[model samples]
Target chain A: MAAPPPAAAATTRTGALTVGLSPYTARTSAFRRAQICRHRLPTLRCRRAQPLTAAASSSPVFHGECFVVGENIDTDQIIPAEHLTLVPSKADEYRKLGSFAFSGLPSAAYPTPFVAPGEESSRYAVIVGGPNFGCGSSREHAPVALGAAGARAVVAESYARIFFRNSVATGEVYPLELAEAGAWKECKTGDIVTVDIGKAVMINHTSGKEYKLKPIGDAGPVVEAGGIFAYARKTGMIASKASA
Target chain B: MTMTEKILARASERASLEPGENVWVDVDVLMTHDVCGPGTIGIFKKEFGEDAKVWDREKVVIIPDHYIFTSDERANRNVDILRDFCMEQKIKYFYDIKDLSDFKANPDYKGVCHVALAQEGHCRPGEVLLGTDSHTCNAGAFGQFATGIGNTDAGFVLGTGKALLKVPPTIRFVLDGEMPPYLLAKDLILQIIGEISVSGATYKSMEFVGSTIESLNMEERMTLCNMVIEAGGKNGVVPADETTFKYLEGKTSVGYEPVYSDAQARFVSDYHFDVSKLEPVVAKPHSPDNRALARECKDVKIDRVYIGSCTGGKIEDFLAAAKVFFASGKKVKVPTFLVPATQKVWMDVYGLSVPEFGGKTCSQIFEEAGCDTPASPSCGACLGGPRDTYARMNEPMVCVSTTNRNFPGRMGHKEGQIYLASPYTAAASALTGYVTDPRDFLM
Candidate 1:
């Protein structure tokens, strides 16, 4: 929109290596150029053109705009079984994967899009939910879809046990449990929020409020390592324990 | 220690155990179906590398039950990915769709993964079974420490044949006194869930004790354990008895030593239930724990009736429904779909190969009663299958179903309502096109 950010255009021409765009630079750059050129009017151009990719961070601190949802948000509403496809394969085409996150949520009820059209999923990194988030189905795709959609963490009053375990085991997204008192009430959509896993607290930058969250406990190291395999490899358990 | 504790201790190779202690245990059987298999295979390949082989091929079972009959290319592709992985890995327990000729045709396929896991004897007593499906806890009926895991954890188990688990505290549910004639295991479980309030047993094991539990058949016990996840339980275990051994008689060749709780074993919480007073129950729309007596919700209208899934599609479940429908002398008022949980159940219901029913099966009885019987054994409309699935709702429909979960939009359209009930209640409700208690028809 703002003249296609000269640097992004230059980088697109050179096909320079970027953090998340490294794998699909050529294809993404072409798509970006087309999207930029197609929108002759500044208002019509995409706001955030950065490929919505998971940024590899060294620390457990995550900061982003919050997307708030209500209680008992089941897995089907997160990502319906119909949209679960092998197209663009999850390994190579993450943007495609992220596009369908929360596609199952009935659009007529919540006019606010979970991942708005033409907006980069990178705009949202935190999800705020009421009680019993991820309440139905053992589908790991629920968290995977959210993670792929650029959610770094989900803060809720409670989580279904299987969903909690799946989130921790895969390290796809951090599931932070908050107390029932004012967890969901204190946060609103698009509120700037920072979740500090090390401190076990979530701070709302918009409202200047702090909420206590449950500690990750035994699952902390695994999530910090970005998944069980990475944790096992780091702790040297993969060779001994996995082989046995 | 309780039976769950003892099983976990032995699996993790520990001399002792305690609640809330994290420990790694070896898995005996691991299963993944079409809906979750592709993601699991993708994760397994990405993490363990393409050349990485599963820990044990024979111990793993891959079944394509969901999204099988649909014409959607994507759903079919999901199965293709599983088939490719199975072929590449040379896995022996992979059950594939034999015929894709017609969408409505009865394809050659094994039943639902959870039912097949038990029927095929993969879920042995005193062992651990893990699957990518939440209903994998259904195997705990055999006195095993079984639980459902997501794809990533399942991938880890696929590559390593082990999972890290925190030993959950055991909650003893003593169902005392004799069960009433009309009360099935479904009624008892619904009553338990209503009391527990869904999140009551979060991260805990539920140990079923007392005479009422012991009196239930293996299918009934499996049904009880299958829905423990509905109440946020880690697993539901029934101590192995002669009934368990008789059920497992030639199904499993693997030697197993039954595990039981010590007489003085401490439980985190103990509760007692009088099964004799239990009545037919239904979980209202939007929540499995929002339970009410079936009679209380009898005035609610319905558009369809679904009787299937690992929780309610067994042979005994079918027989129960047939008993009610055969005696009613009426065709189903609304569309009624009958799906058997497994191939054996299907055969038994149809009196095809099983002579135990004197060649007159539940399928014949239901067919005579004007119920649509799909030949394949699958989890249709249970977890809400594809658009063309036999029982899926197209609009805002209210259905009385026998599946475990009653989450909103679970069976089909987001506006659709589902009421969870037993097969008997479901059949009765289907006949009247409304929520009617099974007793009313029986009387």
Candidate 2:
């Protein structure tokens, strides 16, 4: 649309070596390419063009400003039920959903919105939260909305079972647990943070603090490969969708 | 091994499996509704090819229940998406509701997926069921391994007929005592959630047992299992007995084998409750674990009463509400809404006579009590689908609802106040315009 940013062509060639993941391509074409890339979660009739290969998707690190929420932030608060009619698979609605992310968080308590009014995306690429985060309803929209809103990861004290699993399965957002408790107290909204999964620590650039994190364990590889379907395809656990 | 372990072991074709071991098991059924079906279908088509067939047409059940009867374009489009996908896949158990005007016009339409799943006999003992909706745990009433999964897992199950799952350790909730006519399964579950907080059972199995559970009916058992998700449980199970067998008879053609917890089965934790001593309970607004006794909160005023949802919308639940209405012998002081969980339950509300009311149907009792006409069976206002949904709390009024979870904005307006209660409590509160205990009229 906008003449495929110069970084788009740059990413295709050396995406594997770009650890920080150049903002332009990793933020857009990574998922857009998933639609046509046979190796990633196959989209409708996966295309055969210059595909965004699996190497481009396995970006091992994430760094951005963090939006923060409190304990027991249920799915309804993440993406309310009234907005669930939006089909996450459709590209346009997926972007529209990003605008409504965290719309349900009470305005009185959360004065700072995750996505500003009328904005399709958020300034934050990471979210910090308290215990029992994403604690209600199994709607994948909760994670999908966060990822669509440009959130790369959520570091929290703990997570609900279904939300954590859905995040890993969809490869929408990374759900990481902080080794030390009280991440909510230590972190605040609009904090600059960097998450290094391999190092198992989150660095708060704004506060000049470091917090240890629990490993993603078995779920890391799946999310890195861009959801379970892609991981299964790469590991030969399931056949490629295009060849099926 | 516990009953859950046995069922998981069988599903995975393993001799035995301990807690925390991840294993790939064959899924017996994969259910999706209007809310999640479209995304699941999209994923299935995407990953399996646009022309690919479902792994087993018979095993995939699609129910268009949520967001139905609403005029929202996207909501209606979601149902259309489900219909198109079902037609494309030749899905054997697609419950379609074409007539939004009159649900009766479409006889195959079932309102709520969980209740419909049980009535249609898709739930069986010792089998594994994975669904896209959170209340899929409701089917564990039949002593099965049933749990909710997101769309991605449902899509995977649709294409591969398998799910890689970690076996959850079982928590034993043993209830035993004499009959307590004042209490229902809703009260029992509320009491349990209060005792063990909302996330107490997260990532674990809840095995319900003892003479008290054995004495309840199948619908009551379903009520017990339905809200396990509210407690973050993987699933909740009650061993299949004569009650379960009697209910399943003539409902399904497939054979099923029920499993039981061994006498010395290991449990992560054990809780014992005496049913007779338990009081009617309600979970206050904003959270399901915010529990309070009904009698203690008698002064709290309410604007309306809603009696519906997978947790409390069965024929028996209506009958229980009717019993309270008939006992009070007074018109409702507040607006009261009734929504049955399925078409069959809807029929029963009008057809089956309430023995406590001198042989009158629940509809007749509701009419005499001056409550609103029974809306078509659906998930009405339980999670508040669209702004125009029937009886949705658009005004932020205080209401006593017979549904699970009163989380903020769950019923509609973010400021709305919802007190989750039993049908009996809902009916009693309807008569007084306040949170009244059923014991006042029943006793």
- Residue-wise C-alpha lDDT for candidate 2, range B1-443, written one tens digit per residue: 99999999999999998999999999999999999999898888788889889999999999988889899999999999999988888999999998899999998999899999999999999999999988999999999899999998888898889999999999999999975888899999999988888889999999999999999999999999999988889999999999999999999998899999999899999999999999998999888999999999999999999999999999989999999999889999999999999999999999998666899999999999999999999898999879999999998799999999888888988888999999999999999999988998899
Candidate 1 achieves a global lDDT of 0.78
Q: List residue ranges in candidate 1 displaced over 4 A.
A: A1-58, A85-89, A92-94, A106-109, A117-122, A239-244, B102-108, B352-359
List model 1 lDDT by residue over B1-443, tens digit each.
Answer: 99999999999999889998999999988999987888888778766778889999999999988777678777888888988999999998887874666433444467788888888888888999988888899988999899989888888889889898999999999998897767789988888989997877879999998999999999999999999988888999999999999989999888998889999898999989988778889999878889999999978989889899999999888888887887787889998988887777887787643243345667777887898875467887787777887677778899899899877667778778899999889989988988989997776
TM-score of each: 0.88, 0.93
Q: Any idea what lDDT model 2 has?
A: 0.86
- In the order shown, the chain A TM-scores of the predictions are 0.71, 0.78
Mind giving the per-residue lDDT tens digits that candidate 2 earns over A1-244? 1132233233332232332443222221244444222121100111112335564334356655678888889999899899999988887787777788998888888999988886777767678998889887999999989877767688989988999999999887889999988966788887666677767888787788889999888888887666888788778987664522
Candidate 2: lDDT of B431?
Answer: 97
- lDDT (0-100) at residue B121 of candidate 1? 85
| Interface RMSD of candidate number 1 | 4.4
